[model samples]
Target: MTLPTITATRYVLPLREGGSLPGVVEGNDLGTYVIKFHGAGQGPKALVAEIIVGELFRRLGLRVPELKLIQLDPAIGKSEPDFEIQELLIRSAGLNLAVDFLPGSFGYDGSAGNPGDQAMARILWLDAFVANVDRSWRNTNLLVWHKNLWLIDHGAALYFHHSWMPAEKFATLPYDASDHVFSIATPDVPGVDAELAAAITPELLTEVIGLVPNEWLEDGDRERYLDYLTARLDKRSAWLPGGAR
Candidate 1:
C-alpha cells in the first residue's frame, strides 16, 4: 500500500522531548503531522523501523496515527532561531516519515483509558514479536487521545537491523518484557499470541513492508526483513513473553 504523500508547508515547532528532534509541521493537505526527519541522530534506519512497525501495528487492528510520506523543504526552517534545528531541516529536505498529529493527546499514565487486558496482551505480544525495546515505563511511547490508547514512536524497534549479523541469529533471541509499560501483571499472553501470531502471514508482512518507501531500503534488505520476521514468528516459543501456548 502506498502511503499518502504531502508537502510540508511550514515547520511549526520542535518536539524536543524526542532524542531525534522530530517536529510539528503543517502539510499541504491542510493536516498537521509529527515529522520524523531523515537527518535525525538515528538516521534513516529509524524512519524505516517506524514505517515497518507502525504499519504492522495498524494491520493488527491497533490504534496508530495515520502515517504519511512528507516532503520537507529546508527553506521552511530558515526563520527558525535554533541553529541545530535549521541544520537538521536542511539535511532532511526530502521525503520523511510523518504521523497525523493528535491535537489534544496526553502521554499515557498507564491507568486512564486502559484498553483492557486483551488489547494490552496484543500490544505486549507485538512488541515481543518485533523485538521492540522502547515501550517501557520510563518511556511508554504511548498516547491517550479521546479516551483511547494510540501506539507511537516505533523507531527503536527491529534493532537487529542495525548490524550486519545474520538475521537468523537474532530470530531466537528472547525479549525481556519485565520492563514493559504494561508489564505490571501477566495478561493472557498465550491466548493473544494464538490469535495474533496467525495474522502475521508472509503475505501480510510483504504488504506491510511494501508500504516503506523504496529509498528507505537497500538491496536485499527487503527480503532480509521478510525472512527475519517470518523466522521470528515461527520461533516465538523462544521469545513470547509467557512462553508459547
Candidate 2:
C-alpha cells in the first residue's frame, strides 16, 4: 500500500484559509493536488499525522481524497508574488504531502442534510479513536463533492505525539465531541465502536503507518506511533464515548 510519489511541476495558488498555508500544485503526472508543505507551521509531524490518520480513515471504508507524496522543488515557486509563499516553497523543498484536488467541491454545512445515524456514527467513532480535535462545527474539516462526504485535513489528529508524554496516558483521555460537526446528529458512538473496533487490529495499523514516509518520522517515532495507537485501541473502554462498564 505505497503512496505514489509525484513531483510538483508548478505552483498554482495558495490556500490561505488554513494556518499552514497549503497550496494547489500541478504534479508531473499532470494531476492537480492540494499540497501540504513539510515546512508549514505545523512542520513534518503534521504531514505524518495527515498520512497516518487519512489512510486509516480510508481503510475504515470512509471517504477521503487520495493521498500522495509530492516531491517539491523550491525553485518552482520562485516567480510567486507573495514573499511569504515564496519563502514557504523554499523551505519545503524535497518532500511534502498532497491530496487529489477535487473540483466543484464545497465545504460541508447542514444545508445538504445529515449523513444519517450509521454513517455519522462511524465518522464520529473514528475521530474519537484518533483523538482528532479538528472536526468541530466551526471548522468541520469535511467536504461535499458530487453529493458525497469526504474527510480532509487530518493533520490535526494524533496530537499526542507533539510531546514526550507517555502514549498510554492519552489512551484514556476523554474526547469532547460536543462541538463535533455531527454532534447534533446524535451518533451512537458505542454501537459504532462495537462494529468498527475489531477492524483496527495491529496488523491494519502497521500497514497504515507504513504508508508514511520515513523522512517524515524521527528516531523511534515510528515505534512510538505504533505503540500509542495500539494502546489507544486496547484501552477503548476508558474513552469509547460511554462510561466504562
Candidate 3:
C-alpha cells in the first residue's frame, strides 16, 4: 500500500505532551495532521520507527491513524517567536511525519470497554516483537475516538536501529511485559503470536519498510533494520509472553 505524501501548508500549534514537540499543521491535501519534526533530538530514526511499527499495527488489524510524509517549509512558521521551536522548524524544513488528526479524541481511560482480547493481544505481541518501551499505564499512547482505541506515538519502537548494531546481537532479548498497560488484561498472547508470526512474513516487512523515506536511512541502515526485525520475528515465541515455545 502506498502512503500519500503531502506538504505542510501551515503550522497551527505545538503539542507539549512530549519532548519531541510534534505540532498541528495543515497539509496541502487540505487535511489537518500532527507533524513530527525530523530535527527533533530523537532525529529521523524516530520517524522511521513510527512508520514501520505503525504500519505493522495497521497490517495486524489494529487501530492506528493514517500516516503520511509531510514536506515542511520553514517560511510557514517564520512568525513564531519561540527561538527553540523556530530553530526546530528551520532545521526540519524537509520531509517529516504527519499523523491524521483525530479531533475530539480523548486519552483512553479503559471506559469505552476493552479493545477485545485478540486485538489487545496483537498489540502486546507487536510491542514485544519491536522491543517498544513506551506503552505503560501512565502514558498509554492510546487514544479514544468514536469509542474506538487508536494507537499512536510509536517513535520509541525499533530502538535497536539507534546504535546501528548487527541484527543478530539482540535477537534473543526478552521483552518485559510486566509494565505494559495491557499486561493485566490477560491477552491471548500465544494465539496472537501464532497469528502474527505467520502474517509478518519477509514480504510484509519489506512492504512496511518501503513506507519509510530514503533520507531517513543511512548506508546499509535499511538492510540492517530489515535484518534486525526479521531476526526478532524468528525468535518471537521466545521473547513473547508465556516464555519460549
Candidate 2, residues 1-245: lDDT per residue as tens digits? 78999999999999988699999999999999999999989899988889899999999999999999999987886888899999999999999998999999999987887888888878988898999999987899999999999999998999998884787698887788788887753447777776688889889888988988888888888788889998988888877764433
lDDT tens readout by residue for model 3, 1-245:
66789999988899988899999999889999999998998999999999999998898888899999999888976777888889889999989999999999989868778887877777888898999999998899999998889999999998888886666766878889899988964347877666688899888899999888889887877677779999988877668886544
Q: Candidate 1: which pairs clash? A: none
Q: Against the true structure, what is every candidate's RMSD? A: 1.1, 1.2, 1.3
Clash totals for all candidate models: 0, 0, 0
**lDDT of candidate 1 over 1-245, digit per residue (tens):** 59999999989999998679999999999999999999898888998899899999999899999999999887887777899999899999899998999999998986785678888888999998998999988899999999989999999999888894576677889989899987743457888887898899999999988888888789988898999999999888988888777
Query: Which has the higher lDDT value, candidate number 1 or candidate number 2?
Result: 1
Q: Score every model by TM-score.
A: 0.97, 0.97, 0.96
Worst 10 residues of 3 by lDDT: 184-193
Residue-pair clash count for candidate 3: 0
What do the candidate models score in CA lDDT, each in turn? 0.89, 0.88, 0.87
